[model samples]
Target: MKKIEVFVEKANDGTYWGSTQNLPGGVSSYGNSFDELKQNLKAAFKDYLEVGRKLNENWVQEIEQLTEFEYQLDIASFFKLLPIKISAIAEKTGINPSLMRQYASGKANVSEKRAREIEKAIHELGEDLLSVSF
Candidate 1:
């Protein structure tokens, strides 16, 4: 099965929007929440791929094999789904608690570099946890 990466973000209007990175042009979809967004995105992908296959029948196998999709959530939405406290994560990531809260609340934007740093810290913590034999 082929994997397509989808990036999801929460819009200011309190709606979730998503788009695929590998697909050509600018195809997008929107919904009220993450679960809704997933359903809508799948429908959008089907519609988008159908248009392409209509022009070229060679894309049949590709469309059929395209069963897996991976979603990357934006910082605010990620924090919304995360079960940890901002203060706890701030300590783990070495980020300021207030700043982390602001980012989590969508009151402040987290830069790509800072977001990477935070994610890296979380991954490293996961690796450490995995190393515990007990």
Candidate 2:
């Protein structure tokens, strides 16, 4: 059960694009939305695997056996894909709302420390939501 990490980005035309980070020749795809992008990326990769299989590429065959994909995207890409409000998340994470907005828009670089803070806050929020009975 191998997972290929797909790096995703939001294009200028509001399209989402993604590519495998560990695959050669760059298995990639684009879509109007995130779900569509993931679907297309897998379909494209399967086709590529079939072609590779015919060529007897051992590496491709190994990956083809059970290669799953997981998307890794930046903050800007997350905002583009989800309805999450930046200011709200920022307040919960103790980040300045304006600074968080800049991060979400790719206008600012988030340090590793800040990234971890945001990730931790999101996970905690998810857990809190999961505990709701109503």
Instruction: State every prediction's TM-score relative to the real structure.
Output: 0.71, 0.88
- The whole-model C-alpha lDDT of candidate 2 against the native structure comes to 0.86
Where in model 2 is the C-alpha error above 4 Å? 131-134
RMSD values, in order shown: 3.7, 1.8
Lowest-lDDT window of 10 residues in candidate 2? 61-70
Worst 10 residues of 1 by lDDT: 56-65
The number of clashing residue pairs in model 2 is 0
Q: Considering every candidate listed, which one attains the maximal TM-score? A: 2
lDDT string for model 2 (23-53, tens) is 7777999988899998999899988888888
Each model's lDDT: 0.80, 0.86
User: Residue 6 error for model 2, in Å?
Assistant: 0.3
